[model samples]
Target: MTTHKKIRKAVFPVAGLGTRFLPATKAIPKELLPIVDRPLIQYAVEEAREAGIEQMIFVTGRGKTAIVEHFDMAYELEATMSARGKDMSALDATRATPGDIITVRQQVPLGLGHAIWCARAIVGDEPFAILLPDEMMIGTPGCMAQMVEAYNAVGGNLISVLEVPREEVSSYGVIDPGATLENFGGALTEVRGLVEKPPVAEAPSNKIISGRYILQPEVMRTLENQEKGAGGEIQLTDAMARMIGTQPFHAVTFAGDRYDCGSKVGFVEATLALALAREDMGAEVRAMAERLLRA
Candidate 1:
């Protein structure tokens, strides 16, 4: 097993305008939007932490300070809860050490690659992971953990991929795959090429790069000179594509459910799916679901 540098940090790009969310996001950052009770960003951070990521670097933008605050200590709320003798367990996930959670301002909505480049100083010269908060990954060991396990075996760039409808390939970074590594039981495959939101007709394959990634530090240098590709922005796909043949690049097909919380319908569907799986709400939610379906 090739031992790779530990993936101690994760970069979260939460600078989007959330225009699709409208008035709700007009005031609240979309990351702060809750799936059930906890915010979307919280889930993403927690997943990273569970995967042994020690540091969180959030690439923020204007009007995104709420995301930084969400991870900070709620002194007044904690005090009030303490006074009322209420369980503080629900707020436990929000607590972060003073410097453990760091934020860097992106200043512009350049693109995914630019947002990541903004955190170059923080990420430094080591391997790190990128987790998109809007994509809620639900699994027993977590999406990050699964990727980490695969990284331990291969020690290179590993991205999560899902087989999306061919027409939807234009909405995501499509992967052009080479031969599958049979040693990993066909779960891992060489990344032959990457296209950022390619035309459906020109797409290399139906598999889309899901939001999670284990990237190399060299990617920062590539993004520094990365020209805007698809969508007239510095797409991360272009940067990753440049690194494909130079180093080990593979994709992991996620073996769990992933909810695209960025969309209105996806958000509602994620809520119901997760709500029904919760121990406290399962029975009631299931009954409610059945009733609603009948009506």
Candidate 2:
């Protein structure tokens, strides 16, 4: 039996050029864009922390320095807040211990697979989780925590999945499932392969691969010489598909709803959803929303 090591590190691939949001994303890293008030990246980091992860590895690229600084200690800012006698507790969630945040330059505009590969040295031989900062996973226990629970039971590569309309499968990377892993009641499915955005007729399953993943270190070896797939870029799905069957790969269905903050529509949806959920803002926001709808 293969031993599954404890997952202590998480990789955040923030190297992508946010072309979709245009001028808004031009100067600001899309990961730093706010959903309500908190940035999208903070939500991802907090989720990883909830999963008991110690090391936070960020694969970043050009013009993304603000991301690293966001998680750092702002001595001057904190001191000013203290002098002003203002509550400074909120800054705690925004800061990380000096060594906890490790940023690696991706250098190139490669695909997700290449971006993940940049963190292999930092991830080393341990099993690590991957959370796309733009993909806001919202839930009580958080998606990463739920994925960690399922990983403990199965002990292999695991990716989060959720059902979508069959017709909508064309817009997502769907999973080719074999059977439901017993004991989890149907929450865990044995993933035979992955199909990236297939047409409704050819799509094998309606279960689309969401943003979170817990992968073993051996995947790094496969990615070392991985060939470019769709869009002539190293696709993470291709590498994962090759490892399926050879390793115990399963699709874990998390209870959280994933919000894609990478798109304009998703950004607005997430902002409204999260804003309305906030205790301080909920009532007023809901009233304003009702007024707007009525108007």
Candidate 3:
């Protein structure tokens, strides 16, 4: 049996401008926007915790201080709630477990790789998972938890993969699988190569990359002197591609519903799906949705 290697740290890149949401995101980080009641970023952090990730490192930018503060203890609010006999559970919900969360400011408007590079000192030397708040996957065991399990078994860099429409290939990173690993517990296949947002005609397969990733530390070394690529951004894909032949890289076909919460339509869909799952609101929400469909 492969020895279990626990992933102790996770990197979240939350510094994006969120230009898709436009006016609403003008003052708020899109990650802070709620799906139903809970903020979108909270789901990503919770997923990390569920996967045994002890430290959550966030790469943030200016005006993103609220993202850090939201995960920190709100002592005054907790105190007031206690004085008013309010449910402590509600107050406790705001706090991340002690020593579990930390924030690093990405002062420059670099790309995802650069944002992750800012947290290098804190991440130290170990394989780390990277979760993007914009891509929220709803699942029974949670997306990152599943990826962690696969990573533990295979002991290499793993990325969440799923099939997308052929025309949509350019919207995401595509995977090229050389062979299928036998007896792998879940829907996972050893990845032969990766192509970044390739045109539909050139895409090797329909499998597009998802947001969850378990990457080896060596990739950071690649990113150390990585030059800008594709759209003039320091693409993380470029760095990972450099690690291809050196390290074992694979893709896990995650079983779940992924919401592109970065987009307006996806945000609405997530809100509706989560809201309709709540016992108190489920019936009414279902009825309203049915009525709207009928009309």
Candidate 4:
């Protein structure tokens, strides 16, 4: 039996050029784009923190300096806000301890596998999390926290899965399930296999892998020698696929709504949904949304 250790580190692969968002992303990293007020990456970081993750390892690329600055303390800005009697509590989540955050440059846009491989040094031997900031999962308890709870009971490697329509299975890494375990009032399926973007007819199951993952350290070693799979780029799914039988692998069906904020439509949807959920602006936002629909 494998002994499960506490997860203390998380990797955020923000190296993507964000070509989907084009000009806006050409200057600002997509992870830094605001969903409502907080940037996309902050949500991922907050989720990790809520899961008791102490260290955040960001695999960044060129022109992504803003992300580093965003998490750093802004002495002048904070001083100005304090002098003006502005509430500084809201910025607390963005601040990190001196050594809590680590940034490594991917140098090249190889793939998610390579990006994660880049952080292997920092992650060392612990089981770490990988959170794609673009995938915004909203729920009472954050997705990573939920996964951590499940991880505590059965720990090897776990990825969050969601039941998408059968027709939509081709767009994600479809899982071949083995056995199902009850967790957090949801189901955790033992992942027998993973197929990246399989055609609908060939899909093993409609349970698609979401962006949250609690991967063991051995995955990094697999990724190191991983060849390009699916998309001519090193695929994380491919690397993870290699680690299946070696350890306990499971997929937790996330009980929440996930927004693919990497796309324009998803970004707008997340912004509107988050705005409508806010106590200070819910009524006004809902009223405007209703009026806009009628118009």
Off by over 4 Å in 1: 198-202
Per-structure clash totals for the candidates: 0, 0, 0, 0
- Candidate 3 per-residue lDDT over residues 11-112, each given as its tens digit: 999988889988878999988999878899899988888888889998998888889888888889888988999888744556877778888998987798
- Give lDDT per model, in order: 0.92, 0.91, 0.87, 0.92
TM-score of each: 0.96, 0.97, 0.95, 0.97
Q: Per-residue lDDT of 1-295 in model 2, one digit per residue for the tens?
A: 5546898999999988899988888999988988877888999999999999998999999999999999988999999999999998889898888779999999987799999999999999899999988778899799999999899888989999999877799999999998997788789999988999999999999999998999989999999999999999999999999899898999988787888888899999999998898899999999999999999
Candidate 4, which segments miss by more than 4 Å at Cα? 1-3, 183-186
lDDT of 1 at 253: 85
Give one digit per residue, the lDDT tens place, for model 1 in 1-295.
5688999999999999899999899989999999999999999999999999999999888899988888788889999999999999998889898787999998978899999999999899999999999889998789899899889988889999999889899988889998898987877888999887889999999989889999999999999999987678998888998999899999998888999998999999999999999999999999998999999
Q: Candidate 3: where is the Cα deviation over 4 Å? A: none
lDDT measured at residue 189 in model 2 versus the true structure, 0 to 100: 95
